[model samples]
Target chain A: MDSIYIHIILLALIIISSIFAVSYARVIRGAIILGIVSMLVSISLFLLSCPLAGIFELSVCSGLITVIFISVISLTLPPDEKQRKVNSVSMMKKMVLLVLLVLVCGFSLYMLDSKNITFVPLMQNVQESIDTRDNIWNLRHVDLIGQALILLTGLFAVVVLFKKDKNKDKK
Target chain B: MSVENILLFKLYIIATPVLFLVGIYAIMTTRNIIATIIGIEIMTKGVTLLLASCGYFNGRPEMAQSFIIIMIVVEVVILTISAGLIFNIVKKHDSLDTRNIRNLKG
Candidate 1:
């Protein structure tokens, strides 16, 4: 028997909504909806015994979503200049591209369906230096902290870069 | 719904890459920066789903869950910073479409 059915449903809901949210999200409200979906999914993961992921997901997805949504939404709300050219070709191109993409994705999904979908649980992507499977909990903390710091630094650099470029544009 | 089967967790590993790839394709082809960020999020989310499923399959939760947590952090940060930059670019250049931003035509 499965450990939790409702969580699975919630995850499924999150995944499906995420895909739709991506496709249909034109404005800020739609994006917020998708971000909300991510938050709910994170909560579900926590309920399934993954508190670490749950906490970050809530922080990123929920914590930043409201402000980000409002800001992004407000940024493009009213065009100050009537510089919009209204290109019709771009819309047609996007529609055609979307159809082709759907076809390809459908075919790929079909192909994967016929095969044995489950892998051998060989832990393919995991780094193998930590050989002991049973005792990984205590071991990963140090590495996680280091990688996390590096990641934070990288994010800071990116923001500074963006700020620099925007200032350059102003000049 | 078929994911309810006992073997579905196992299958999630295979499905994960496809989801990630498709999401990337969406991101690359779409010109909208927001859509692109959403695409990147999808790809990362697929990886998390894959890792979580793998852990569930093998009955190991610690490592996978931890990575998922890290990914969530990075995703949020990247999404905000990039989105903010794109918004700034759009405002300054007067175009939400990214293709038109290249003013250096050398």
Candidate 2:
């Protein structure tokens, strides 16, 4: 019973923080709110019996991603104040409508008969105590290789994108 | 499954789609490029929740956790590359507005 309540609270926090994340006028504030959303998600993952994923999310999404966003925001110039004010007013109006839509959707889904829905049957022959580490290192080695290759590609991309072009500088 | 598990699953079903909607609306309504990326991140979060819940209910938490870990790695790489792109875009345009990039001459 308490677990259900905790999940509900976490869901509400995720939704509210996500709303604020997109609605904030300042990008920095939005980035910070996004971090909060990620944190809540990590907690929810933990509750859902996914401690490893939760740890990764907490460290990568909530910590690394937020820092990356902040650094990007710092590198760029701020938007014009007058333009931002105009945009914010219109955005607020849209946000109100969005909130209404979400409420309606939530109510309708709540009233839904989920019992009618079918899901995959639990695999009885599978090992009940398999470790996530073993699953990743042994069962999902291809994904690990893919991750490494993609990381290398991303590193090269960043280096090329940020490198100063000497010819352009001379021109 | 227990009553509590079913309730948790229901909560995930309802909340995941709501998060996706918010993300889509953000991407649609915002003109800033960074905000678009943020919207994408939000949508990814929804997907993560869905995957986690599905794994939990399916008795395959290990599989789901591995997938999520791989997903996080891919997401980080994508984000880093996008950040680099945004950096260059800002350097050339002097603004973060997506409208400025409408004219693409290869």
The candidate maximizing lDDT is 2
User: What lDDT is reached at residue A53 by model 1?
Assistant: 66
TM-score of chain B of each: 0.80, 0.94
TM-score of chain A of each: 0.60, 0.80
- What's the residue-level lDDT of A29 in candidate 1? 52
Candidate 1: CAPRI quality band: acceptable
Error of 2 at A72 (Å): 0.7
A137-166: candidate 1 lDDT, tens digit per residue: 466656567667867776786667555556
What tens-digit string does per-residue lDDT give for candidate 2 at A21-85?
Answer: 98777889999999999999999889878999999999999999999999999988888897676
Worst lDDT run of 10 residues, candidate 2 chain A, spans A112-121
Clashes per model (N, Cα, C within 3 A): 1, 0
TM-score of model number 2: 0.89
Off by over 4 Å in 1: A1-8, A76-92, A117-120, A124-138, A141-149, A152-155, A158-171, B1-5, B10-22, B25-29, B102-106
Name every residue pair that clashes in candidate 1.
A118-B10
Worst 10 residues of 2 chain B by lDDT: B2-11
Cα lDDT, model 1, residue A58? 76
